[model samples]
Target chain A: MTTLPPPSPRKLGLVIDLDTCVGCHACAVACKEWNDGGQFGPLPDRDAYGAEPDGVWFNRVHSYAVEPGSDHAEGASNRCAGPDPESPAPKPGLTVHFPRSCLHCEAPGCVTVCPTGASYKRAEDGIVLVDEDKCIGCQLCAWACPYGAREISVRKGTMQKCTLCVDRIYNETLDEEDRQPACVKACPTRARHFGDLGDAESAVSRLVAERDGYALMPEFGYRPVNRYLPPRPRRDAANAPPAPPREETLDREKLPGVLRWLDRVLSR
Target chain B: MRPTFSILCFTVLSGIGYGAWFLQGLAWAIGPICEAHSAASGVPWELCPVAFWTKAGSMLALLFVSTGLLCSLGHLGKPSRAWRALSQWRSSWLSREGVFALLTFVPFVLIAAQEVALWIAVVRAGPDGTVALSGWVSQGGLPRRLLGFCLAAGSLATVFCTANIYASLKPIRAWNDRHVVPAYLSIGLYGGCLLLAAMTVDRSMEFRDHRILLTGTIVLAVACAWLKHRYWRSIDAQSSTTTGHAIGLESLGTVRPLEAPHTEENYLTHEMGFVLARKHSTKLRRIALAAAFLIPALLAVLTFVLPRVYPLTVWLALASGIVGLFVERWLFFAEAKHAVMAFYGR
Candidate 1:
């Protein structure tokens, strides 16, 4: 069974909304808290009190500031800015907070590169996992991973990675509402959404369709089940008459043509 | 990219060991032509008896290979679980390598046993005035021929498997190339030839065809150096795949890393983000080239200048070759930039 399994029918995964994320790392903290006592618990730390402190965490948030007009060539500055080619205007840049974990890719390179039959991807749910007992901890799996998902725990002397909170998601003992991944449930901004992406009618799929969700490093061809919604372009809202006071707009629209029209627009 | 000591030792030492076994097999295939010119030249064996050399050479090869295998095991987190590595040879290059290296021991043992038997018979038979070339290397014998063939095939396959381990990694653009296997093969041959030359010349004796062996070593050493130079140049001129392209962020804008996920170093950064100073690397490369190839080649030429220099030159060649290979192997790992490092902005 070292060979890869056929594609799973139910690609259960998460979709993250970049526009709404505040980069508070609540999800990352929640993930550590739950998983520490879950399947792969006590995700150990070393030299905690020393100058160099290192530990393992399934979810890690990375912030990136996409500079304005950095991608544009010299003369094409205004030509390709503002997202759409027709806009012909530059847009202000915004920082994006990326919380990364195992993508549970359909073709997980980490799984295929294992010398021992330690790493595997589940055909039922597309969750990539490591068999701790079987792993020789050669760290080759980490090398094969393009997203830096695989981590070797020197303390445990085995490879570990995000299991997508499998222990909780399928646990029938827990209440139905609490069965979701720890990160998704604890996200304060409600930026994380989880559902079966393979289902056409799934809410996550609809969000993906609406928000133009994209795969990270698609060229690597991992075909990650997770998707990220890019930050929306800022609305300029530049052209407008000065608004009347709030109390004045609330008054009845009995006025001259311009005032009435402005009141109506403001009220609506 | 971290250039761990165990791995550098394993790759370089094991390569020479396999190369030696393969050449011995080739000599077996070619019959007594290899041994005829040696003992018959009335040359004196200044080291030990010729039988001792035959037995000792095979032992040295086994020692090299076993030490290398053991060194590699040290790098594994669970050395006790190393047996599981052989399970996935059908799909994994590393699995295939473990299988092939283990399989090579069969032929290696057989060849060594044959040499031991021959040596014992020679010792019991006493100093039979003329040490007939036909007495030792019975190339026409069916058992020896078959075993030699197996040894050659097995050794070559092991080398190929080792090379494939690096070449199969798609993320390492420098390793995944046509140049990798040939570089490994040629270098293995060169290192093996140096070992062979050193063994062929007995410090207590002189060999007539020692010139031929050392000459072959020179040729192989030069070939190894030339191929390595070409590989280095190719990698230097190569335009590596960018992080922007890796992340598919080129279409959006310059994909600069705003911050690392962790403040402290993780396994990925420690292993993949290994960086060596350019000036130090260049200095090391020079030392490796001089020791591994240049000095050996020059000493080999000096063997032609006078017969007295033959044994001394072979010893120097062997010494320099080992040092050179070690430095070269270190550079191989140190210079390699893993694709995963792109995320860390390495």
Candidate 2:
């Protein structure tokens, strides 16, 4: 049962837009709250109010400062310092908030490494899942995953991870609009979109094509279903022409004699 | 990558157990070739009237194996459900290891059971009386040879499965390497030779007289030391994946974590974020090589020069080898950097 299922033609996954994301952790919180009370209930926190509050979460938001001149850089960091007249200038890196979770790959190492056959990928939808009953909690699946998606539940002595909200996505009780992953539904900016990525005609698929979305660490060869739309090029770097020479350039003649001398010395 | 005590004990103890079994199997299969005079006892090894040494050696090997298997259960979160692990041998290396570990017991128990009967017959015949060889449990017989082959093949295969469990994991570059399997085998055999040498000090045995065992132990010790040294060098030279790759944004400018997902340690950080200082790891590596391989090997060589103190030196070698292996195992886990750490901007 640890063997991967045949490729699923209908890959149900997410496509996240980095340009639109605001680094808010609402998706992460919603995922935790829904899962804690849903089918995978009791995502326990060991010390909720104590010094070391440890708990399991299906999603986590990481904020990174992407510097300019890198292969993917659009321009200098968004927070780079303005022209400074005094001290040495500092390059403030651009912030890119990344929400990390399971990618639900077509060939996931996590599913195959499980000794207990607890981890498996669905042939119908390509969604990877764990059967808690069969899991001996050796944590080998966690080690096999490059994405750090699996979390060991110390209290239950079992592995926990993003299920893509299986229970809600197909629930008849929920309204049609609400029938989606908790994280996707909770995104305030609509940064996360969910659909059958396997179908090119699907809105999510077209969105991916238009945005030039990409899979994470494709070199790992998991063939992840989920895609990420890289942040769009910044306005200044995208279409703006070179700025006209500043007409009001500083004039040394109008400066005091001491100031003009200081400027000359500094420039030298 | 955290070096849990249970896992270290399982790997090290089982490696020694299997190593001893391999050597014992060879001796059993060779039949007449192992007929060297035990320096401690005046009788020849193969023609010895009493089967006490053979019986004790087999049982000791079994004991080490059983202890190691038991320790491995501690690594599972749900130990009660550990039986489920053996069901996936078709796909999982860990599962194959479990199945083989259990299957190995068959040959060991069978050999031990027959040896017990042989020992009883020799005891009842009295020290001066000669016990008939008969067809059963006869030295160099077909059945004995077959069992010996089974034991040797089974032991090596189980160790191979164990090594593959680590080597097959692609995310942990340190474990997923060409050197891991060879290093494991060499270390296991080295530990095994030390165990055999120490077994000679048993009260029933009189001398440290097995030349092959002593020489094999020294050779394996040197081999293991060199293999581990190479392993350390390779891992040290390896470059890890960057934060850019982890976030699937390598083409973007350099990625630096501005904020961690959590304020306190999470499971991923606690499990995979283990980082040993360069200075500390280097020191530990030296300690492991010196104490585990170099010193033990030197001690084994010294036993050959001072046959007067063979027992003392062999025992000392085994003791030092065990201590050094523990340190090495600790380093093996502690120094490994998991690929997931890239997301943490580590």
Candidate 3:
């Protein structure tokens, strides 16, 4: 009547600090690199070098300039400014970089809609997953998900999603410090953190309490496990002196060959 | 709620079939007790041939139901891989539907076999002779009664399965409600009553039994109409899940998207972006009323007023009612709003 070893408790989740993120897509690239090589390999890119470049990425950072309660002549108040070049209005106090991924919702509609039982949330850790062997490529689960988490793998004819770098994070051979998700590790500004929110003493738990983190589309009642800290107010840039004109800028022609090459690459 | 045409056809057709069976059963249960005059009055009770006709109706009903089931299987992306659907009976409603549908077949087959065997035995025994068989290995009375129970159980189970399929969808606000089950059952009853009216109405202009069926059909039809109207009104009053304040975009207050995700329609757009215009929906509702309720009601009233115009009116009303029900079922799926609409920024 005895059973084998019980499933491991690995509550993989993401903690995004909106204050530090600069809207750069480093975490997205890191996620693609790690996921493409590890368990859910090769997130197929359609027309990578073509005119319409589209592919699946586990993480996507959306940039928005939020103006907090602006008293403008046009009667625009609390409006997110359009990212247009022609706009001559004063800049917003805060620019937000929102990175979205699977929240790993406790009440996952994706799993329940799967006729073949391919999509399921792990009872052990609450990580939502799709069983490739059982999937029938119905795409019903994708339709069921409000977050747009599931992406169809055309080649495999099955749904794929963020696994939070499960294979790498759980690897015993890797060092404890190096076992975090690829996105969390690659966050240059240290905006992304990975930990179990279930544990009250966890880093993510502590941060959530301190920052008053919010979940995306809370009215949907998905009860997303991931937490997003709101962006802090911008510093007073009006008092600071403006930079020198472009014509009076320091000459780059006198720089070393290596330095010039580095400049060119960075500029590109 | 992705409206597979197969399922729509199945529900509509099976609704008629089950409705016909239910009406016929009701007639059978009540006809003997009440000395109600059948339209075919000249035809004797022994030679009335009601049993044979009822059996035929049952066969036709089961055929349509099975055809619907087959069509539904086609909606599955991998039909051969559908076996795995039965594995998650513990939590999944789809699994429950599959299991119940298969289980319903046992009784359906039993009813068919028993009825067919009884017919064959009757034919073999001749008019007057008592056909006798061995004690333990013989002609059974229990089989016929068991067949009745099976047909009743199967009919109910099939309807339950249909209701559960829609009711299980959590994202669709229209489907995930207490009203869905009752609405489905009512539609099924309406479809059955129309079928029964068509079958019982005398071809040579007989008035008996036509009024009762017509009245029953009208009541069901009107109830469906009322329910549908209420459902739509409720949905209209409901607010969007996403608000301007929630998205941090209060300047363009309560914004609806001018464009969709892609230039060319993707899977999500194709599946969920089906928008029936208000004018078209209004027109369809009128048509549904004419076919499902008005025609049947008029025919029922006409049967009492002009007894000579019985069969033609009843048959025409039934034919129109069925077509109307198909349209109604289509609207039921089309009108439903999924919670995912919030993500689309609708």
Candidate 4:
């Protein structure tokens, strides 16, 4: 059963926009909160009140500093000037907030490497999942995965991973608007988009195409379904448009009615 | 990768077990065929004290194998459901290894039973400490030969499956190396030779009588030494996957970790993020090589010169080989850098 199912056309996956993520970690928190009591309940934390708290999490966020034009063989060129001659345009370093999770790869090694049939890919939706009942918790699937998506729960003695919120995505109990993955719904910046990536015309697919989204470590050949949109060139970059003037004051009229009232009250 | 004690025991102990079983099978298989030819020429094949020692060795081999299997259970989080692993032999190498490991017990049990029956049938001490067996004891020549060959083939095949479990994993560049399979096999067979030499050492037989076992030990020692050297050299030269590619940010320059997702080490880091100092690894490698390959090979050669202390030398060699192989196995897991570490900015 660990053998991969035939590739399905309805690959439900996510496309995240790196340029919009603020590294707020709301998505990761929301994921933990929703899944804590959902179908995959009790993501147990060891030493909850003590030092060195650790637990299983389906999603995690990492931030990195990306320096433009510093990817050369010569090494980091953080202070190097932009191409503008009249103005000394110092190239700025960009901090990219990266959220890591299961990519639901078409050819995920995690499934194939599983000794038990616990880890499997759904032929219906191309979503990878683990059957806790069958898992021996050998953790080989975790090692097989290059993404570090799988985690073994010490309390449950079974492997846990991002299910893409399978319990919520298709659940009729929840309102239609709230029936998507917890992470995708909780992103304040609308950075995470979820839909059928297999369909070329899907919004997530178009967003990927317009933003030039890419799979991480494609050289490993997992053929991940989820894609990440790279951070757009910063305003100070040589080819980017000129920066706009700074805003000196907030316009109360432009703010939403509730926010405007709150602003006025805070000002008083 | 973290070098868990249970996994090290499983691989090393089982490796030595299969090695001894393979050697025993070779003797059983070859002895019958050669005896068949000798009997056709009206000559009798003498039964020596080695027959008793060989049976004892077989029992010891079974003990090592079973203990190794038991140790592997400690590695599983859900040990009770370990049998579910045998359900996926069609695709999983680990499953295939489990199936083969279990299947190998068949030939072992069958051969051990045959040995016991033969001992029961021929129970008489001759003048020169040689046991005389009835001529009819050599009956069922083809069946015994077939079982013997099956035993050898099964032992090697199971070891092959075990090696493939690590070699097939593509993410760990160190484990995925080409030399891994051959290294496991040569080291395992070499361990078997050491065990056999120690167990089968008879005072009645001349030290030169152990030429085959000593020669095998020396050959495997040299082979394992060269294989491990090449394996280490290859892994050293291999460049790890870059951080830029890991995060899909290679177009931007030199990505560095600004902040980790968690304050404390997570399971990923704890499991696959082992770090070994270069100086420590180099020292350990030298120690492993000296104890495992150098000392054993020297002891095997010394058997010829100091034949009086052959028993002592072989036992020392076996002891040294097991300890050295344990260290080498630990390094095998400890030094391997998993690809997931790239995301952690390792």
Number of the predicted model whose TM-score against the real structure is largest: 2
Q: Could you give the DockQ of candidate 3?
A: 0.15
DockQ of each: 0.51, 0.61, 0.15, 0.63
Q: Over all chains combined, what TM-score does candidate 1 have?
A: 0.86
Give lDDT per model, in order. Answer: 0.77, 0.84, 0.66, 0.85
Which candidate ranks first by lDDT, i.e. highest? 4
lDDT of 4 by residue, B1-346 (tens): 9999999999999999998888888877777544554456454443544555566677778888898999999999999999999999888889998998898888777766666666665553433455544443442355566677788888898888889889988899999999999998888788888888888747544433257788999999999999999999999998988778899887787777889999998899999988973438999999999999899889888876777776888889989999999989999999999999988888
Rank list by TM-score = 2, 4, 1, 3
Question: Model 1 over residues B1-346: C-alpha lDDT tens digits?
Answer: 7888889888988898888878777666654654564446544332134434444555677778888889999889899999999998877778888998888888767766666565565676678644343533443465776777777778888888888888877667677767899988888878877787777736433543455567788888888888888888877776666655545445566555777778898777788887873348778878889999999999888877765665788888889999999998888778877787776556
Error of 3 at B202 (Å): 3.7
CAPRI grade of model 3: incorrect
Clashing pairs in 4: A71-B253
lDDT of 2 by residue, B3-93 (tens): 8889999999998999888878877776655444443456644345334555555667778888899999998899999999999998899
| Candidate 3 regions with alpha-carbon error over 4 angstroms | A1-10, A20-38, A41-97, A137-140, A151-157, A172-178, A185-190, A217-222, A234-268, B14-47, B127-146, B204-212, B243-266, B276-280, B296-315
TM-score of candidate 1 restricted to chain B?
Answer: 0.89
Task: Please give the distance, in angstroms, between residue A130's alpha carbon in candidate 2 and its true position after superposition.
Answer: 0.9
User: Which of 1 and 3 is ahead in TM-score?
Assistant: 1
Q: After superposition, which runs of candidate 4 have C-alpha atoms over 4 Å from their true positions?
A: A69-92, A237-268, B32-46, B123-140, B204-209, B277-279
- Residue pairs clashing in model 3 are B19-B192, B20-B192
Supply candidate 1's per-residue lDDT for B68. Answer: 84
What ranking of all candidate models by DockQ puts the best one first?
Answer: 4, 2, 1, 3
Q: Residue B285 lDDT in model 3?
A: 71
